[model samples]
Target: MIDAHIHLEQYDSEVSEQMLRELPSLGIEALIAVSMNLDSCIRTQKLATTYPRVVRSAYGFHPEQPLPQETELSNLLEWIEGQPREDFIAVGEIGLPYYSRAEALERGEAFDMEPYIQLLDQLLELAARLDKPVVLHAVYEDALIACDLLVKHNIQRAHFHWFKGPEEAIARMIKNGYYISFTPDILYETEIQELARRYPPELVMAETDGPWPFEGSFAGKITHPSMIRDVAAAWGALHDYNPGQAEEILTANTKRFYSL
Candidate 1:
């Protein structure tokens, strides 16, 4: 099975090494290691290199964090351009701001979106130029803007990871044939279950977003790639499929989406 999205670099060295050691035992075939910034991109690349088949790197600045300096962004782009094409799977963990913006506003902190939109444009342009799939972090109104930008750029292979939006936006994503992933939250979150039921299986994938944690049955557990199997089970139950069959379908969707 494939963990379609995760931050393998976020874990401590001991945990990371342990997880790597257990990959085969857990039945996890591969992981799409999504980056949060230039440092994360570098670390993810190193992990992929060390673990080869166990990790596929995806480089991008995560949208929730403070935007990077122009020089930093330029360096990151240069680094991406210099890498072997087969080493990275996509340009991802990138999108317009949402949750973080809300939190900042609630705290009366200054929140600006102009820079974020600009960054998203540059990332999308890179993805289009590279002809690679994109993993998005856009949600709610941000999702609407992201959809518009994707359409404008004519990017056909996009993955809206852990997506959440109104029905209309969800419909648009389905119509556009974009992929969306469900997390372990689906095991207990009614909304996630409904989302799995609504989105077509071919366009659906599973992820643990490991080391980020989760609630319900996943509460108090250090998130792991192995948790994705439970997500697949939830997807199966929601979609009226055999759990193993759902896992196979999700694995196929992830492989094709990332061209693994």
Candidate 2:
């Protein structure tokens, strides 16, 4: 099975090495290791270089953190542009900062939405130019704006990872034939399970977002790619598919979406 999205570079060196070494026997075929920033991209690139058969990299800034400075942004974009096409599978872990903005607002910290939107605009434009798929972080009302930008760029291949939104936004994504990945959260979150029920199965994929942690059955456990098998089980139960069938379906969908 392929992990559609994860931050493999975030884990400890020893843990990551052990995980990568044991992955094949655990039934994990590959991982789409996404970047959190330029440094993160470098680490992911190195990991991919070492595990050529098991890791595909995606280079882009994650929006939950502080926005990048002008030089930083330019450097990241230029670096991505300079890389060979096969170095990365997509431009991602990028989008509007909904959760971060909301947290700031609650803290009574004045927030600027325009700059984040502009940054996403720049990133999406880059993705379009590169002719690669996008892994979006947009959710809630932010997803609506993201949908608009995606259409503006005429980007046909996009993945909304760990997505949750209102009916309108979900419908918009579906209309565009965009894909969405379910994390291990689907095992315990009714909201996530309902999302699985609402979305077209063919457009669905399974992921663990590993090393980020989870709760319930996954509580206190270091997230791992193999956790996606449990995600497949839960999701398959919703669609009346057995465990093996679910894994096959999710693996196929991920391979097709990422052109693996």
Candidate 3:
């Protein structure tokens, strides 16, 4: 199994190292460590350098930050362009947030998304120029808008991780051949389960979105790559497949999507 999205930087170095060491035993073959800030991007790249086979990375500024001024945005773009592309797998963990609180927004706290929409457009241009896929993090109407940008840029390779869109947007995504990943949330999120049911198995994959476990079953718990098994199990139950078969299909889907 693969944990398609994780933040190794969120954990301390020693603890993150220990976790990586345990992943093989836990059935995680590879993990895509997503960066949420510039500093984390550097750290994520370093981690991937040290554990090349176990970890890969993605680079992008998260939407949580307020939109940078023009000068700052240009500096960020230059910095991203200067990074070693081979050290990363894609450009992602980028998109808008629909329900940010006022305080969060004031603190540059909540996800405003306007800046991210601009960022997405630039990232898509970058992806097209570099010929790489992107991992998107938006839900509902936001996801639809992101897909629209992808279409506009003709950037066909994209992964909409932990999707939470309405049926109409989901239909549009499927029509566009955009892939979606299901996290362990499937155990509790009927919406996620319905998404699993609506999409073809070949286009569907599983992720743990590690460091964040599902509620009820594992409240206040830290999730890991190994828990993808549980996600696969839930998906199997929803799709009426044997556990092994479901894992095989999802594993294949993930591999093909990430080109792992």
Candidate 4:
């Protein structure tokens, strides 16, 4: 099965190399390596070039970090614009800073969400112009804003990875025919499992979001693309489907979404 979203660039070089070698045996096919920033995009592109059959890159800024300066933003946009169309699969790992702003507010720090919203709007505009699918990081209230921007730009091919939000947002996404990916947490997190139950089988896929760890049965282990097999297992269990069948459905959904 393919990992619908991962930060392969974040993994240690030796570790990633070893994992790539093991993928065939693991029944793992390809990874959608989403970028965190310009540097991350560069690294991801290199990995994709090195293993073109295994690593597919997605270029965009992650929202958890501070907003970029004007020069930085311009540079990133230009860089993404210059990349060959086939070089990256989507505009990804981009959205409002929901977790960051929530943490800051709880600590009595002031946080402005508008700039992040504008940033996402610009990135969504780029994705629309390029006619590429989007991999989003938006969750909770931020997801509502993301849905609005997606509609504003008529960006229909959206994949909300490791998503969590209210029923309203979920209904909107389902209605819009957007896709969603399940992480390994579906094995243990009730919230994630509930989402698995809600999303349509054809509109859903599996991911590791790797180089970032997971808890439950995944606790303390290095995240790996092969773990998505377990994610499919858990998701299938939720809907009373067996593991092999689950993996096949998710794999097809991923291929259909990314045009892999």
Q: CA lDDT of each candidate?
A: 0.91, 0.94, 0.80, 0.93
TM-score of each: 0.98, 0.99, 0.91, 0.99
Check candidate 1 and list the clashing pairs.
none
Candidate 4 lDDT, tens digit per residue, 119-226?
999999999999999999989978899999999999989999989999999999999999999888888888888888988898999999998899988899999999
- Which segments of candidate 4 are over 4 A away from where they belong? none
Q: RMSD of each candidate?
A: 1.0, 0.7, 2.7, 0.7
Q: How high is the lDDT of residue 259 in model 3? A: 82
* lDDT digits (tens) for residues 37-102 of candidate 1: 989999999899999988999999899888989899999888887888888989989998898999
TM-score of 2: 0.99
Model 3, residue 183: displacement in angstroms?
Answer: 1.2
Residue 114 local lDDT, model 3: 64
Better of 1 and 4 by lDDT: 4
User: What is the alpha-carbon RMSD of candidate 1 to the true structure?
Assistant: 1.0
